[model samples]
Target chain A: MPERVARRTWPVHAVLVVGALVMVAPLVWEFLTSVKSFGESVRVPPTILPGTWDWSNYTKVFHSIPFGEQLLNTVLMTAGRTAGQLLLCSMAAYAFARLAFPGRDVIFMLFLSVLMVPSQLFLIPQYQIMQELGWLNSLQALIVPGVFSAFGTFLLRQFFLSLPKDLEEAAGLDGANPLRIYWHIMLPLARPGLVALGILTVLWSWNDLMWPLVVNNDPEQMTLSAGLATLKGEHFTDYPVLMAGSLLATLPVIVVFIVMQRRVLEGIAFTGSKG
Target chain B: MSNRWWKVLAAATVVVSAAACGGGGSGSDGGPVTLTYAIWDKDQQPAMEKIAQEYTKAHPNVTVKVQLTANKEYWTKLQTAVTGGSAPDVFWMNGPRIGLYAAQGVLQPLDEQISAAGADTAAYPKSLVDLYTFEGKKYGLPKDYDTIGLWYNKTLFDAAGVKHPDATWTWDDLKAAAAKLTDPAKGQYGIAAPADSQANYYNTIFQAGGTVISDDGKKSGFGDPATIEGLKFWVDLIKAGSSPTVQQMSDTEPTQLFSSGKVAMYYGGSWEANGFAKNADLTGKVDVAPLPKGKKQAVVIHGLANVAYAKSKNPEEAADFAVFASGKQAQRIQAEAGAVISAYQGTQDTWVKAHPQFNLQAFIDQVPNSVPLPRSKNTSAWTKHAEDLLLKAWTGEKDVADAAKELAKAVDEELGKEK
Candidate 1:
C-alpha cells in the first residue's frame, strides 16, 4: 500500500517541479541576458551562459534615467495609493454593507461599471480633469485617479457581509456606536480583505506606465516603470542596455513581492471572487 | 459640512503627496518657479543637458526641468499635457506633428522671435523650414537635419573583391555587387533590403520618381508604376537570396548587422555614423556613398525641432531659449561633436571631419537632391497603417503589387477623412 501511494505521488512531484522551473526560467534568462555584452547576446544559436559579465550595465541604467529617484517615487506613490484605497474602499464598503440608503445599489452599480468599461475610454476625459486641476506631472495625478476603487469597495463589501454579526451586536449592546463597532469589531475581521486589496492595489500602481507617462514627463516625477520608457525612442538600439535598465527598474517590485509573498499568494488565491 | 469634505480631501491629499506640482518658482520663502523642458530623444540626452545648463547660465531665477517621453507617447503625452495645462515650456516637435499641434492653437509661434534674434531662415534647408510654417508663421526652428545614404562595409567589399560605392554607382551596379558578395553558408548577406519606412523604403519611392503623397498632400501615389518598381527591387533581392529571410532580419536591425561586419551593405542615415563609429568592430571599415540612382538621385532630409508651449507663464524666456537653441553657437557645438548634421547649413563641414574614416562628405553632397520628408496633417496614423500592410508583403504573406494597391487605397481613404 505504501509503495503504490509513493508511485502515484512521485509523478505529481515531478510535474510541479517542472512547472516551477518553467515559471522561473524567464527571470533567470533575463538576469543572464542583462550581464552579456550586446554583441554576444544576439549571436546565432544564442549563449546559454555568458562567458563574461559586464558590470557597466548597472551604471548604464543610471545614465539611462534617474533610477534611484524613480524607484523611490514609485515606492511612495504605490504605498500611498494602496493604503488610500484600502481605507476609502472599506468606508464605502461599510456604508453599503451594514447601512440602509435609497439608490445605494444604483450608485454601487455605477461605480462597479467603471471596472467593466475599458480604461482607455476614461483616459482622455480624466486627463482633461487633471489638466484643470493643474496636477499634471504630479504624483497626485498617478494616485488620485484610481483611489476610490470600485473593485476594492466591492471586494471588501462581500467580505464584510460574510463576517459573523455576533461581535458587532455584542459591541452594540455594550453601548458602542455603529462607527465604534465598525472600527473596533468589524475591521479586525476584515484583515484578509484589506491584505488582498492592498496587494492588488500596490501591484497595479507599481506596474502602471501609460497614465503616468501621460501625466508626468519629468524624470523626478516619473515612477520607475514610466521612467524606463525613456530608454526606448523613435529608433531603439542597445537592447542590452534596455534589458539592464528594465531589470534594475523591476528589482524593487520583485523585492516587494519576495517580502510579501505569503500575503500576495493569498490575495492571488482569492482573485476569482469577482467571478 | 458636506461641502467641506472636498476641502478636507484636498488638504489631506496635499499633505499626503510627496511629488509636488508647484507651478511657480521660489519667492522669499517659497519654492522656485518651475519650467518643464520636454523632448523625445534619449540618445540626445547629454547634448540636451548641456544646452539646458547653458540656458540656466543666463537665467538662474528659473529652473528648467528636463523631461523626456518616447516617440508615440511623446505626442500622446504632449497632447494630454497641453490639454491639461501641464505642457512643457519647451518641447521637441517632429515635422508632421507641427501642424496638428499648431492647428489646435497649442504651439507658441516663433516668427517674431526669429526676426528679433536676427536668425536667418535661409540658413536652414528650405524643405525643412517649410514644415515649421503654418499660415505664413513658423511654429518651430530646425535643430538638426539627417540625410540618408548607402552605407557599406569596406572590409566586406575588400574581402569580396568588389569596388567601393561611389557617385558613379547605378541601380544595376548595386544589384551586381549584392549578388557577388552574398555568401549564405557563413550567415553573410549582401544587403539589408528590408521593406521599411523612414529609413529604408521611403528613399526608393523618391528615387523612382514617385511621390508618397502629392505636393498638395492629396492622394497617395504608392500605386504608381515607379513606386511599385522601387518596392520590387527589395522583393527581388529576397527572392534571389541576396538578402536574409524576413524571419532572420525581423528582430535584427540592419545597422547592427553592418557594424558587426555581418552584412556587406546597409542603407542608413548619416545620424547613425556616430553609432557605427562607436562600434569597435567597424571603426575603420564602414564607409558611405551616394544612394544608387533610380530615375533621379534624391534623398530624404529630416530633423526634429524645438517649440515653446503657449500655456507657459514665462513665454518670453521660453521663446528666447527656443530661438537661442537654433543659433549658430549651439549649432557649432553640435557640429563639432559629430552627433548630428546641425540645421545650420555651413556647420556641416565640421560634422564630416568628425568621422574621418567614413566618406561623410557624400551625405552632405546629397543634401541638394534631398526633399522634405513626407508629412501630412495626421501622418503617423496613415503611415502606421501602411507599415502593417507592407509588413504583410515583407513576410511574403501578400503579393507586393496587391499590398501596394491596398496601401494606396487606405491612404486615399485616410486623406478623404482628413478632408
Candidate 2:
C-alpha cells in the first residue's frame, strides 16, 4: 500500500512546484530589474538577466528622499497600531461574547455594519477630525484613527464564541469578578486569534498608501510606501531606481514574515475552520 | 443602559460639530511668513528649489517651502485639502483644470498682481496667456510651453532608402514613406496610431481644418466632415498594415515600441526630447521634424502655470511669488536647467541649445500656427466619454462617421449640464 501511494505522488508534487514558481516570479523579476540600466529595463523582448549589475540605483534612492527617517516612521506607526488593536479588540470581543448587557445584540450588530462600508467614504471626515485636533502631519493622526477597527473586533468575537463556557463559569463560581474572569481564563485560550489579528494589522499598516500621502506633507513625517512613491515622474519614470527603492523597503516585512511563518499559517488555518 | 448609550452618541455628535466650526482661519499677516509651494514633478525639484532660493534672496521676510507630490495622486490630494480649507498657499496649475478651479472660486485672479509688479504679460506667448484666461479674468501666469512633432528612427529611414520627413512633406508624402518603411520579415511597422488626443488625433484634426470645440466653448466639433477625415487618417494606416493594430498598441505603450526600434515614426511632444536624450538605446539614432501638413499647418500648444490660492493666509506674498516665478529671470533659470522650454520670449534659445543631437527647433518653429488646448468649464467630464467612443471606431467595431455623430450628441449633453 505504501508503494502504490508513492507512485501517484509525483504528479501532485510537480503541480505544486509549478504553483510555487508562479507565486515567486514577480519578486524575482523585481530584483532583476533593480540591478539593470534604464535602457535595458525597457527594451522589447526584454532580457532575462542583467548585462551589467549597477549598484548606484540603491544609493540614488537615499539621495532622492530621506529613506532612513521614513523607515523609522513606518516602524513606529505599525507597532503602535498593532499593539493598540490587539488589546482593545480582545476586550470588546470578550464583552460581546460572554456578558449579558442591556443592548448587547443591537450594539454588536452595529459593529458588524461598519465592515460593510468602504474605507474611502471616511477619508474626508477623518481628515477634518484630525485638523480639528491639530494632529495633521503627525504620527498620532496615522495611529489614533486606525486603532479602532471593526474587522478586528469581529474576528476576535468569533474566536471567543468557540471557547467553552464551563471554564469561565468555574472561574465565576470561584468568587472572581467578570474582569478577573476575562483576564485570567478567556484570553489565554484565544492566543491564535490574537496572533492572527496582530499579523493582519502589521501588514495593513506597513503598506497603507493613500492616507499617509494625503495627511502628511513633510518628507520627515512620511512612511516608506509614500516616500517611495515620489520616485515616479510626470512624463518619464526611472523604473530601475523605483524598483530598487521598493525592494529595499520590502526587505524588513519579508524578514518578519519568514520568522513567523509557522505560527502565522497555524493561526490563520485555525481561525478559518473555527469561524 | 440603552438610554445612556443614546446620550453618549448624542454628546459625541455635538462635540464634533462644534470643533469643526472652530478651526477655520489660520495665521495673520505679520513679521515672517513661510508659504507652501506644491508641485508634481520629481525631475524638476532642484530647479524649483533654486527658484525658491532666488525669491528668498530678493525678499528677506518670506521663505518658500517646496512640496513634491507625484502626478498620479496630486489632483486627488489637492481636492481633498481644498475641501477641508487647508490647501497650500501656491501650486502648479494646468490648462485643463484652470477653467474648473476658476469656476469653483478656488483660484485667485492674478491680473491685479501682475500689473502692480510692473511685469510684462506680453513677454510670454499669446496662446499660453489666452489659455489661462477664463471668463475675462487671468487665473494663472504661463510658465512653459510644448508642441508636438514627428519623431522618426533615422537608422530605419536610411535602411529603407526613403527621405526623412521635412517641412515640405504633405499627407501623401507621409503615406508613401510609411508604406516603403514597413517590413513584415523584420517584425517592424512604419508608425504607431494609438487613439491619443494630444499626440496623435488632435494635431491631425487641426491640420485637417477642424476644431475640437467651438471658440465659444458651447458645442462639440466631432460631427464635422473634416474631423471625420482626421479620424480616418489613423484608421486607414492601421488597415493598410503600415501601423500596429489597436490591440497591439494597447498591450505595450506606443512610445515604448518606438524607442525599441519596432516602429519608425512616432508623434511625440517636446517633452520626449528630454527622455530620449537620457535613453541609451536611442542615442544618436533619432531626430524630429515638423508635423506633416494636411489642409493646413497647425499643432496643439499647452503648458503649466503657477496659480495662487484664493483663501490663503498671506495672499499678497503668494501672489507676488506667483508673478515672480513666471518672470523672465526665473524662466531663464528654468530653461538653463534643460528640462523644459520656458515661455518667456527670449529664454527659449537656451532650451533649444540644450539638446544639440536632435532638431529641437521644430517645436519652436510651429508656435506661431499653434492652437491653445481645447478646454471647457469641465473638460474632464466629456474627455473620458470621447476617448471611450472613439475606441470603437479605432478598433473597427463601428463606422467612424456613426461613432463621431453619437459622440458629438453625448458630449453636447455633458456640456449643457456644466453650468
- Per residue, candidate 2 scores C-alpha lDDT tens digits across B1-419 of 33553464464344334322222233445567788889998877888888999999988778888888899989988988888877788899998898889998898999999999898889989989999988889899998898999999999999999999998888898888888989989978899989999888889999999878888788999999999888889988988999999999988888888899999999999988888888899998999999999999989999999999998888898998999889888898888877788998999999998899999999999999898888888999989878999999999998988998999998898889888
| Model 2, span A51-128: residue lDDT tens | 899889999999988999899879877876777787789889999998999999999999999999999988898888
lDDT of 1 by residue, A19-104 (tens): 99999998888888888876666555567887788878778888778888888778777866876787799889988998879999
- Candidate 1: count of backbone clashes, pairs at least 3 residues apart or interchain: 8
**Estimated TM-score per prediction?**
0.91, 0.94
lDDT of 2: 0.87
Model 2 in CAPRI terms: which quality? Answer: acceptable
Deviation in Å, model 1, residue A104 alpha carbon: 1.2
**In candidate 1, residue B368 scores what lDDT?**
90
DockQ of all predictions against the true structure, Cα-based? 0.47, 0.30
Angstrom error at residue A69, model 2: 1.0
